[model samples]
Target: MASLNSRVKGAVMGASMTGGWLLADLLLPEPWGDVVLYAAMAVVNVGIGWRLGKFYDKQSDKETAADFDAKKAANYELPS
Candidate 1:
């Protein structure tokens, strides 16, 4: 599992990269320019998707942990 700091850093990096690629695409000249930009966009999209997946996995793990804690608490019995 990644520490919270790593996850935050990854998300920030992904957002900035995606935004920069988009802005560059708008400013650059045509033909191969669009092609190159699209390629970069695709790469950034994949990175964003991967990052989102990681976040989902982390959320699931947290939910599972909370469920286990709840179960453990419910099953606690008084001493005989």
Candidate 2:
């Protein structure tokens, strides 16, 4: 599930960055357009990295909790 979410997030970011670059190229001129496009891409990539990090952290926490729960369950024993 986390993997799926990450893939979808990556796809969306890639598409948006491409679209933004195209739009900037059409609206701006020459060096300025290229500069803007690069800057936008850099910022978007940073944001994507940050988001993915958080998502992975959350997924890890869930997995850790599940493992702990399983260990506790295994250690339990009923009275005879």
Candidate 3:
């Protein structure tokens, strides 16, 4: 499994791959080829979105945890 940053990098690579395929298809004559390329591009885009959502969820969880910890500390008292 790759890190969040690596996953984003992979997504960027996927975009370039799709671009290359599109260009190649344009150079050659094949109507259905474009459809296949578009489908692949859509899948990559979905994956990228899912990965980004996961990254944001993780950050939110950390922030929530910190907020809870701070509140707990503020409520605590010590004997003199």
Candidate-wise lDDT, in order = 0.85, 0.84, 0.82
> Model 1: which ten-residue window has the lowest total lDDT?
1-10
| lDDT of the structure predicted as candidate 1 | 0.85
**Candidate 1 ranges with C-alpha deviation above 4 Å:** 1-19
Task: List where candidate 2 sits over 4 angstroms from the true fold.
Answer: 1-13
- Per-residue lDDT for 1-80 in model 2, tens only? 36578679878867887886788788988888888878887897798789989999999999999999999987895657
Task: Give TM per candidate.
Answer: 0.64, 0.72, 0.64
lDDT score, residue 55, model 1?
Answer: 91
Assess candidate 3 and give its lDDT.
Answer: 0.82
Q: Which residue runs of candidate 3 sit more than 4 Å off their true CA positions?
A: 1-29, 78-80
- The candidate maximizing lDDT is 1
Clash-forming residue pairs, model 1: none
Candidate 1, residues 1-80, lDDT tens digits: the string is 25569879878877787788879988989988899888977886898789989999999999999999999987896668
Better of 1 and 3 by lDDT: 1
